[model samples]
Target: MYCFMSTIDPGPPPQLIQLILSYLKDGQSTTEFDLRVMPLAQDGSTRRYFRVYSTNKDSFIAVDAHKTGGDPKTLSAPNQNQTFHYLACHLLERGFPVPRILQHSSDFNFYLLCDLGEVTLCSKVLENGHKNKKSTLELYQKALDLLFKLQTEALINFEHSWCYAGSVYDRNLILENELNYFLKAFVKGYLKLTVSPKSESRLQAEFQSLADEALLAPGDFFLYRDFQSKNLMLKDKMLYLIDFQGARSGPFYYDLASLLNDPYTQLLQTQREQLLSYYYKQLCNRYPKSAPDNDTFTFFFHLYSLVRTLQTLGAFAFLTRQGRKHFQSYMAPALENFHHYLARLSSSLKLDTLVELSHRLYEQNLNVKKRSP
Candidate 1:
């Protein structure tokens, strides 16, 4: 027999709750009002979310992005609330399906957004048992279409300061931030293994080469740094994007890689290929001059996929180490995807040591699970 216990977390402070209620009231008078606050499931980020329910059953999401030590701005560049508000408002104005910012505190630390219900594309994929390829492909196609709009239509007169990372996704950011993140978070932290000086040099060189190659692609489009099924919400069959505060200017391949290589969805190889072809065709049709040749685009797709996979593994390792148990479930899948990318790369890249280390980490995780009982 299994016993389950539920502990309800009393959301934000009473004063904060009242302030949010007043904002929702928007100068309207109600004889009797009741409000219920429920904490939502936490994600890898430091942001806290609560669903606010009123007597009329109207709902909105309250975000308490108070000054957490590890706020994204500390690592990225812009204020979390500011980036979210700017990007949300920008996308919403352009007819993109993002949550509307209903209200925000004067200081911009807290805000209310349209409640986009609980079903994410990731949840929908899981509900279908990840076997309904047809349905899954349709959802992905819709997501890709929306992404096209973000890259093109949303780029018109975009402000760089609005992005958390103000600069375009450049080689240095890729090498210093992303590649180093993988080394520190996954290689050293998670696997408890150290890279030899020679291996480290080799890894850095390879990363630099890959980043340079990826930069050869166009750099004018918006890159959704974490575009995946988890960030996509489905309401009434319309897909909405959330958690886009990390958006920046970069090659289009980055977002494509993120969506296709997303471990949460674990899209099959054939499905990914078909989707890639679909996206390429759509890009050519829509922006003929901007789209790169199929070969060049595919090359960057693979490279960006590797980068995204490594960054994701780094995040999983870092989060788990930080005592975020919710991230632990993603470790094995992330490792699997990491291996998938490593296998696809050429042996001449000299990533054999990294590949071996990843396999050892995967095996070690399995051993730990076996011993847990």
Candidate 2:
């Protein structure tokens, strides 16, 4: 279980409770299952989770993510439920290890899903406490194999319209959501640093240049925006994906960067290089005509790794500011990652200000550590 998680009060709402019970009733002989709702630990999302038990059946995961507990049509934004349900069914049909959606309400707010085991890949890696244990490396290899399928086979017959915001992951998104997020959230919010107007203009120019490099990455593949260890659940020796509603169309290297540079496991450079070579070999075997050459792919890998690290720092800073201090601890590793990738691509990207800021972040982290004990 996550140390950060605690039981939230009052449990799920009334409508969600009734929906879960009714679904269980229809299948069971006595139609009696668990009505005692137990709250489960939540991720970085706004959704509420609960576990419903049963004597005959294994168990079920109950989700309550309603915008409001009112009429179904009252939802105004692009519904997360619709996207999750569609993606879950789509991936399941394609032999992906996603949870099966057992039932849902008319609004699609509440849902009952098969309980995937409680162990996340993050838990397994942390427990090992070694960066490159054979077991841990094996698990990552399996994850990469699954990732290959997700980018290749899953793209066939895939409809982008069913996705939430849109299909494409464009330069504008990079500028606003990611690069700009680093500028606003991390540089300003977390570090409490101010940027001069002239320096800010220079930063925007650098951001655009980085965005252009990002667009040059190889392949037309499905990008699992948050494909980190925490989002991967291990069950019965297989890894399953979760929290993938942010899936979009982008270059394959972005997700690779997310995985290899993930702060949770803090994989060593040697491990990362070995895995990169392994995945590249897989790509060559499958898409020989389309796969990028080693030098080109390596360049984009470093570029995208830098881009992904900046975005992660922004997210970590924002989450920490919101009172999630656990996220703050992760920032240390992420900043270390920022330094690593930035140093590699130091010549290619003109991020002098960001480079200095990263140094400050590191120093601040060290200061905090010293002040602690």
Q: Give me the candidate number with maximum lDDT.
A: 2
Off by over 4 Å in 2: 1-8, 31-34, 67-77, 362-373
Candidate 1 segments whose C-alpha is farther than 4 A from its true place: 1-7, 68-78, 347-373
Q: lDDT at 308 for candidate 2?
A: 87
**Residue 28 in model 2: lDDT:** 66
Return the TM-score for each candidate structure: 0.89, 0.91
Give lDDT per model, in order. 0.78, 0.79
Candidate 2 at residue 95, lDDT? 89
Model 1, range 1-373, lDDT digits (tens) per residue? Answer: 1111226765575545756767756766763567667788777777778888776547888887766323453455567678888889888888899998888776567778889999999999888865788998899999999998888778876798886555489877888667789898777876667778987877777777777766777888888888999999999999999999888898888899889888787788899999999999998998789667887777677777888888887887787787775666676676677777777765435566667666677765653222211
Clashing pairs in 2: none
Give lDDT for model 1: 0.78
Task: Pick the TM-score winner.
Answer: 2
